[model samples]
Target chain A: MKRRRRFHIQPKHLFLILLAICVLLIASTSYNTFMTHSIQGGFSTVLLPFQKGMNRLGGLVYGKIGSIKELYGVMEENQKLQEEIGELRRENTRYQLQLKELATYKELLKITDEYPDYDMVGAHIISKNSGNWFSTFKIDKGSRDGFSVGMNILADGGLAGIITSVEAHTSTVTSIIDDGRSVAAMAASSGAPCMVTGNRLLLQEGKLDVTHIDKDDDIDLSYKIVTSNTSSEYLPGLLIGYISDIDKDTNNLTKTGKLVPAVNFSRLDTVMVITTLKRTEG
Target chain B: MRKPVFYACVIAAAFLLQNNLFAAIPLIQTTPNILLVVTFVTAFIAGPKDGMLVGFFSGLLLDAFFGGSVGFYAMIYMAIGYVNGFCGNYFYRDFVTAPVLLSVLSDLAFGILVYFFGFLLRGRLAFMDYFISIIIPEVVYTALITCVVYKPLLKLEERALESSKRSAKRFV
Candidate 1:
């Protein structure tokens, strides 16, 4: 008698096949194939409406909870704000007089605008990455809204991040606080060049790592850090942060310090994207 | 067919909540891995095959949404599901300790795998910092949330299984 032979699909075979598919997917994505982009775009487009709805709902709930929690402190804060308003009013008059003097100086020097006007669009953050591994988040604006990768995002009047990926109706922003992100920056007062590097550990203390400043440069806590004109990716003169501390490197050729960022990243809701891309010279 | 559809919906809802609602809530520095809880619980209740399928789709959703690369998350989640499936034989509806303990272990494994691929391979040699700052907090949070989320998921799975069996009997 001849024995009958049968084929069976074991769990091991299934696992191996799935693992192989995952490897292929990782490879294709790294190469940035058009197929992967389209697939990602399609998924984003389909999920956009749901994400928007959920974001709004979450915001509402968060707002309610915050208001209730702050009920006891509201009166105290109000009094403090009123006192601050009185002080600001006096300072505003002084600033106005200084502004008039500056205008006269600018006219005397015939200095037209130093920086060109940037076209900007407002966007709402829809969702953030679930894991804490990276600080990437999605915005409501997308490619259709004239958004593209590398557009600088500003929040609280300071550079927050740059657009990394754009889909049909949403785009992802990799903030300056994310690991491996670096910005070419300089001391606004002395023009001493430095580098602002993102380190999540450092960010826990609400500061970024500012490194590579010339040892001889006269940079101090009073100098604000701004994006350097030499930077190829970021727009020149955008406020990044203020230098909180500085120290000479062990090599003695450069200095490093901590930067207290102007933007409060933990509470970002709305941001302005400078639609202008830094034009690279041919 | 119905079972798959039901599980898919559950996973999708969990993904949405993880990215939007829980993320927005300032409960802690990091949100619980609700999706991981969902995958592990399903795998613990249902068998290896269903667990793998659920894990694959959940990870794919994450990849398509915000992951820098595709398949990285999918692979991690799939392996997690497959490994957790072995616990099905030991799972009991009333037993809470097993699920919570499994959740902590699985989250730890997940954090380590993510660190290995996302950070360690990138030449980021600070293992102690990454482990303490990110991996530990996430594991503790995930374990805490698993206790709250496990019961509802188990109830849902049991109902779905009963309905599917009833429908199959009717068809037969």
Candidate 2:
């Protein structure tokens, strides 16, 4: 008699089945949609305190190390700063004398008299995304701190990123150098427009790709790139990077170049969120 | 220590160290994945069930804190734990080779899976650059850490199991 053996599921088999189910579930959903309001949100909410405490501890340790290192550079930096301040004082007096001339020049140029007032909020980076690339990081400040998705983030005197998501106590910043991030940029000197986009290849070399420049535009080394006046989301005149290695595209109608990003993403620890969103100008 | 609570504390502590302390270290960057080491060691020492549980929770914690996708890392880590757990029976308290080899294999799998699903699917095709620049460094770093942390983790596993067994005996 061929009696059917009793069916039994071993723990390993059960684990494999569960793993398959999870993989299939993730595969079926659109990645972007599945990320929002999913179990991750709850986990973030729960782990906030621990992350915050750990970050504070790490910050304290890093601060001490930084202070020791800065001791060696302090005298040199002080001398340099004093010299610069003296030069700036002379320049300020000279600029004061030329204020009337500058006003007339502004009028002739038809430039706006008032600049946008940028409200700022400071935040500490609590953790980075689970990858080798420093593309995304979570800050301790969140919606409660008046931070929200799409607010521009700045670090190290450069436009860093835009807030991608916000929870109550933390938010995520997707940096300008991240794989999918793109910024509308222009040469600060000539106001010639271009697009700066993140490229992994360029990121390895600590640079970004600047594309769509008209072939005739005389972009050159050391030219500053800033957010374009045409960018709807980012505020105009925020420094993005410096242009380098301008080369014509294969089509020859346009040019592309590499930009050394102003923000050193690897050293990011703190950032300022420009609270005010940019209004699209006509 | 109670097994479940021990696992929870260790995983939480590992998460904190990975996100905060190790991440803040300049030379380390994100190369040494401390949590991955914990997952690999736990799976290697305790077998499949423990491995899956550790992987799921740690991966979920990682995803929850900094992940874009909720289940992406959780799924990857869980698979890694399960696969590594197969070698659990062959583990010896004094032997480090199995754990080290398993760590390399697991870390390599993680690097490939992440590259395949995250970058390749998204049209990033610079395989040689990525393999050399990111994948190799991370795998080597993770494996090196495994060598350092393996003995301690095995000891921890032994104590936790012994305590659990004692509790079970008392219940009887």
Candidate 3:
């Protein structure tokens, strides 16, 4: 069979063979939606107990390491806070201090008031998606208590992926890193919008591309990109991250930018899920 | 006839362990190429035809489980077994460093094949991130397991042959 390579495949013949096989596999596996779900469910049930047990074991080990690392961040932050406190004490400007407090209070109130209807159940992450799970994670809570599929998950910064699958005790948060996820986001600065995709293939270029950007648009670095509230699976104003780079279409109205997700996803340990944010309009 | 059944049992047992027991090991982030490792080792130990068949079946099972194109696993694994068998006939089976090196290489090759085909299906995706974010970590995890897993699996292999249970032969 060893000979000089010939690159030609008779296209019609090859196409037929491929089509025939696809039909065969589909016929074999696709009994019905219910049947498919049941089979997947059966396999998932077998896997879930294993996944949960491993998650707990890994959580214990990582938790200790995380606490140590957190302790170090806390000490560092405390020293910085102490310095700030000293400055506040020295200035003793009651009027300015009150202004700062008032602004922060207003912001916090707005966030709470906007979502007063939803109950918040906070969760601590126990384990990453083992290998290649930079895009998905497991939280220590699940459905029997109240969580369900398609719940909006967020942390201090922005929207996480929806809960694709939920067990009695845990839910899988598919991250923007998941190949299956995409978000419609816009530049907070330029008002230009584009699709923010989470496929890891862009990591090869060291960053993701927000394509179809307008060359004439005011695209700049650090332009805040948030989920476009109008037509997103995410609630409005949840920060995904800022644009670290801008690819302006000088010739068109649309602009695209590189997203640097706000959350330090590498060490994400805790997350907040908004269980009840729904549109009351039409 | 007996050898085929024996090999089939070994492959099934490996799949069961991969889906079940291997999860208990901590910080082992590699994509336990349970099927890949078994197919390669079996091809190395048995011969080309048996190894290739085993690998194809294992790959088929992997495809069914992981939600990808069906024959993709078979294509890569059968190649692995075929090549491993080709090498087996010539190379010393006792080379201590060989398993580690061979595993890393095969997984990488398998990963690249996955990426190449995945790219064709889904356009304009990140190849390096998939490699760096997913594949490399999995390879390292798989490589590390070789050290711990090989010793025990080898002993079991010896015991399996010694016991010769399936053949109605008494344990020697």
Candidate 4:
């Protein structure tokens, strides 16, 4: 009975055993927190020998590989011959395209000789942040060369946008169709100029609007709208887009119409940014 | 203990293989979820709570690979495990057809619940699209995988559980 009673601890001794456990936990945690760097160093020392052996083995294998590659001249010659054949075929196609393009440019130069007042820069649309598409895009031109902000970036056919941001190796162009941008445009047929808001909402639907022109104005389908010299910015007669829709308002003072953008947003590969800002003498 | 360690190693290895190796076997991705089937086998064999615990962690591991929000998978998987356990109380005799259908249902339930929760978070329900595109296809694939993975895993779990019970009886 006494042995049984001794084994079965009283409530007081139970409390003492629990107290000892608490002390052990506290000491271990404090020691670990303070001595972490030293404990890590001990593990690093255990791993050192294997790491050294791996490094030595890697160097030995790489040296052997260089010598073996040097002995394989015949295989290298065959690969070079295959690469040359592929390049020649590409060159032939490019030459034919250049000849065809030169003839067309000769005709365009004859027709547009009156517009010597305009300076043109051609560029490519390289990459889009289409995940955030409406805001910005990157082009492969920069300030260290001739590119600068406010330079009008043009495609072969029409005005894309002015350069908004420039870096040493890249530039970002905010398109004329974006919400925050507007252009001073005029109907080519009517010779009437008005403020045209950017067609961002329409662009999302694959359309653009030339706003602020009157319903009585002669803005019709397929006629060009160009950036004008009259209102603050952009040169005169730079093509913006073609008039696609004429919304006739019998009641309102001014008319708004949809313009079909000449620049295809898709299939954009290359463009040039005209590095010109007209300096005011004031 | 060794088996659990081995299973952990297999989990690590499957992940590495999925990300790294070029597939010699092209059929796996289109047909089934190997890991999900393994979790299901473990659940039914372990019976409710332990199965829930294992399923919850395995689902979490899968979700971690996908970079998903943490607790979403945990809640769904725990529910799957708990339900699997409750169903374990039913007739275990007709396993051939039963296991396949039950696995399909469970996978469908898990996918639907996750989709429903996603809709609630987004504040609009896309019920038709979610059921048609995500849940049904996932269930079909999960069912195909469970058919192959369950038999072997069930046998292993049976042996382990029997041994554990014997050990418990000895202590008693």
Candidate whose TM-score is highest: 1
Residues B76-172, model 4: lDDT tens digits: 6656666676666674723746678778878777666755665435443556655665466667866875776667667766776677666555655
Model 2, residue A172: C-alpha shift (Å): 0.9
Tens digit per residue, CA lDDT, model 4, A1-282: 123223554433433443343344335534553232233223223423433343344345545665687669757878887889888898989989998999999998768633455555555443342211133455655565677767776675677777765555455677777643689889887877656665333554556767778767777778788887674556567777888777766677777777877777643446656566644346
Cα lDDT tens digits for candidate 2, B1-172: 7889999989988888877776765546555777888887888778777888899878877766666665678888888888888887766647888778888888888888888888888888988888888888888888888888888888888899898878766765
What's candidate 2's i-RMS value? 6.8
The whole-model C-alpha lDDT of candidate 2 against the native structure comes to 0.80
Encode model 3's per-residue lDDT on A57-148: one tens digit a residue. Answer: 55676667778989999999998998799777767887688899999999996674354555667886644443232356667677766887
Better of 2 and 4 by TM-score: 2
Q: For each candidate, what TM-score against the reference?
A: 0.87, 0.82, 0.65, 0.40
Q: Which window of 10 residues has the lowest lDDT sum in candidate 3 chain B?
A: B20-29
Weakest lDDT window of 10 consecutive positions for candidate 3 chain A: A32-41
- Measured with C-alpha atoms, the lDDT of residue A35 in candidate 1 is 56
DockQ (C-alpha based) per candidate is 0.50, 0.41, 0.17, 0.06
Give the per-residue lDDT of model 3 (tens digit) for B59-161: 6554444433345555667777766766667766666477778788888887787677655366736666677767887788778777666656666555655
Q: Model 1 clash pairs?
A: none
Per-residue lDDT tens digits of candidate 2, residues A1-282? 332334656767778776775675465444555445455556677888887787778778888888888998997799888879977987897888799898889786544322347788888888876477547888888877888778999887689999878887788888899875789899988999999999766887899999889999867788999999899789888889898788888998999999999898888888989999887655
- Once fitted onto the true fold, the runs of candidate 3 whose alpha carbons sit more than 4 angstroms away are A1-36, A63-114, A117-149, A165-173, A188-191, A201-208, A213-219, A230-232, A250-253, A269-282, B1-35, B46-89, B125-141, B164-167, B170-172
